[model samples]
Target: MSIRHGLLALLERGPMYGYQLRAAFEESTGSTWPLNIGQVYTTLGRLERDGLVRALPGGEGGQRPYAISDAGRADLGRWFTTPIGRADPPRDELSIKLTLAMSTPGVDVARVLRTQRKATMAALRRFTRLKQERAADDDLPRRLALDAMIFRAEAEVRWLDHCEAHLGRPG
Candidate 1:
């Protein structure tokens, strides 16, 4: 989820002021993804300098709107067609936490897993509540998004259970 590229996609829809882009991105993603307006404007400026967008002068007190250029459309098309191969190193946060836990001689690994299990279960419950709230509001899209989050949280909880189960097994 590159906010820079996501902003480009929004501009491709039509010309938009920076604030509009920020709001649309947040709403479309159910407010799960956060964006900084300053960062958006900085990226928009770079896009303009790169010939991917053109900034039109503001009207009176209104903000200046930016539109995607022909070059920008082409760049977006290339991005769509290209596969995003993994170039950056992977980050396994849970593995790192577990490694530290193993190194701490007095650390209780089971206690750590139990704490994580409780947190993950709480997350799942929170997401479920969010989904129910969205359902009551009759917002299908947001409910769906919350459902995905709930499912992911439950999956992690299950994985924690498996890890705990194997903690004392023969190597």
Candidate 2:
């Protein structure tokens, strides 16, 4: 996830202190991605340095709020309009582990796949339950986030099954 873009998106609303930005980010993502206060501040500093944001005068109790600059607004707009390309996908740790397991002596690839499948299934169940429990009027962001996770988990399980089949395991 792009913390820089996330913070810029939040600042698009208006000026916000570091704590407020953190809380808003968590709330927007349904707490799926929690941001540390320090991380928030660090990103803000970078944004300011890049001229994407400007730190306003300190408010009461010395709370320094940040507001998005014109460049920030343009960047945020680009982010929203651009489709996320998967040309360079992030490295999946599980994929790396499975690949290593295949080449490592004494490593049980089937057992490893089975273990991951079981865990992924459990996560799918949890996401499904969350979806069911979500109220109709719940924020769309949270619902969409949960749906994305559910879909990814389902895809993972399918991939695991494929691996098993290729290994000559019984369907």
Candidate 3:
């Protein structure tokens, strides 16, 4: 997810300082992605330089609030309407590790898969438990975020099982 776009979306609600933007970003994403205050300010600075946001004057304790510019609104609108293309898939660390492990001598490929599967299952369980525990009171955005995580973890487990099965097959 683009922190730049995320900040702009939050600023659409109104002008907000770095701390407020960071908190709102975490809240909107169900705290799955935590942002450092420094990172937020850095991104804000970039946004300001790009004319996507403008600094408002005289915030409390020198916390300069930023309002999204018209350009920012247009950019945010494009982001919302545009389908995220997977043409250039993000590199998966697990995939990289497994590929290297298979080729590296004495790497214990089986152990690698087993360890990852165990970790993924634990994460899946935690996500499931959170879903069950908060089913009654959680807001829609948070529930959706949690659900995505649960699905991804579940998929990872299935992929690991497939990998194990492939390991036993004759070459």
Candidate 4:
């Protein structure tokens, strides 16, 4: 997730302190991805430096609130309109581990695949349960997040099955 864009989007609502921004972020995303307080401050500093956000004066106590600038609004607009590109896909640690297992000596690729499949299946079940609970409450953001996780877990299981078959493992 782009913390910069996320912060900017939140700032669109109004000026907010670092802690407030962190809470809003987690709340909006249903806590699927928690933000570190330090990270929030760091990103805020960078945004200020980039002129995307300006620190407001006279914050209560030591807290420094920030507001989005016009540039930030334009950038946020572009971010919303731009489609995420797949030209450079993010690295998958599981894929890297499996590739290394294939060539590593005395390493059981089948065992590794089986273990990952089991774990992924467990995660899928958890996501499904969460989805059901969220659906009951009509929590749209969390439900969407859970759906994404479920789909990814399902895909991982399918890939593991393919790997097992390719490695001559019995079904």
Better of 1 and 4 by TM-score: 4
Count of backbone collisions in candidate 1: 0
Model 3: runs farther than 4 Å from truth? Answer: none
Ranking by TM-score: 3, 4, 2, 1
TM-score of 3: 0.97
Clashing pairs in 3: none
* lDDT of the structure predicted as candidate 1: 0.83
Q: What TM-score, computed on C-alpha atoms, does each candidate reach?
A: 0.79, 0.92, 0.97, 0.92
Top-scoring candidate (TM-score) = 3
lDDT of 4 at 151: 92
TM-score winner between candidates 1 and 2? 2
Which pairs of residues clash in candidate 1, taking residues 3 or more apart in a chain or in different chains? none
Candidate 4 global CA lDDT score: 0.91
lDDT, residue 41, candidate 1: 88
Which tens-of-lDDT digit does each residue in 20-138 have in candidate 4? Answer: 99999998887778999999999999999999999999999999899999999999999999999899999999999999999999998989998898899898998888777777766
In candidate 1, position 35 carries an lDDT of 85
lDDT of each: 0.83, 0.91, 0.95, 0.91
